[model samples]
Target: MILHTTEVTPLSGYRLLLRFNNGAAGEVDLSNELDGEVFEPLRDPVLFATASQHPVMRTAAWSNGADLAPEFLLDLMRVQQGDRAA
Candidate 1:
């Protein structure tokens, strides 16, 4: 089944606590992902903390337009917990 992001809370150091539609949630560190022009603005902790769920429900993004796909976020959670994605 496809999943969607229900909530997003920005954590310290470019990390985010994301809750999904399926009741799955986790912390995602995006410090390394902030390299390109679009993502560069998010490198600032303050700017990164502006993350919010988009109306489409598929992901979360910052004011500068840097966003993460919910599927990718879920996969990261699966890998971190050693649980395979269904």
Candidate 2:
């Protein structure tokens, strides 16, 4: 999941538009999944947008003192697959 540009549009929930280096794109909805301090900063749209521009996006913040993980993306991907399945 090597991405080129990741544009995150925060809707009613947190939605991410991931554009991969290979031209593949996917979206991740992180509404119900995150409801803790790790997501608190993201409540601020500006901070969230800036974080999304980082190399690893939210994961980096989560890694450095923030309470979250890179696995969040995998979970989101699973949710995406589930949506496609249904």
Candidate 3:
């Protein structure tokens, strides 16, 4: 998923205000989700020290090294958003 943070605003607690390129803006509460390995590094103050240090873009490749369809990206985005795209 492409997480382009246009503006980041600190909430009352550990939540963050995220504005995506699709114009779907929402607050992702990460207070409890930060315990996982993928998000554990985000707790470090150094990662945020550099604005250029962002998550790497990983393209979805098929078994034959072929690029996945555009629908796949959309499906992934929906899954990440806690929705099952039918």
Best by TM-score: 1
lDDT by residue (tens digit), candidate 1, 1-86: 78899888888978888888898877877777788888888877789889988887568888887787898888876776676433
Residues 1-86, candidate 2: write the lDDT tens digits.
Answer: 54334333334456565543434346666555556766666665555544343455433242224433445554465578773411
Is candidate 1 or 3 superior in TM-score? 1
TM-score of 1: 0.83
> Which of the predicted structures, 2 or 3, would earn the higher lDDT when compared with the native?
2
What lDDT, from 0 to 1, does candidate 3 have? 0.40
Residue-level lDDT tens digits of model 3 in 1-86: 55343444445444444444445455544445445545555454444222221233232222222222323444443555776322
Ranked by TM-score from best down, the candidates are 1, 2, 3
Residue 17 C-alpha lDDT in model 3 = 45
**RMSD (Cα, Å) of candidate 3?**
9.9
Measured by lDDT, the strongest candidate is 1
TM-score of each model, in listed order: 0.83, 0.48, 0.40
TM-score-best of 2 and 3:
2
Where does candidate 1 stray beyond 4 Å?
Answer: 84-86
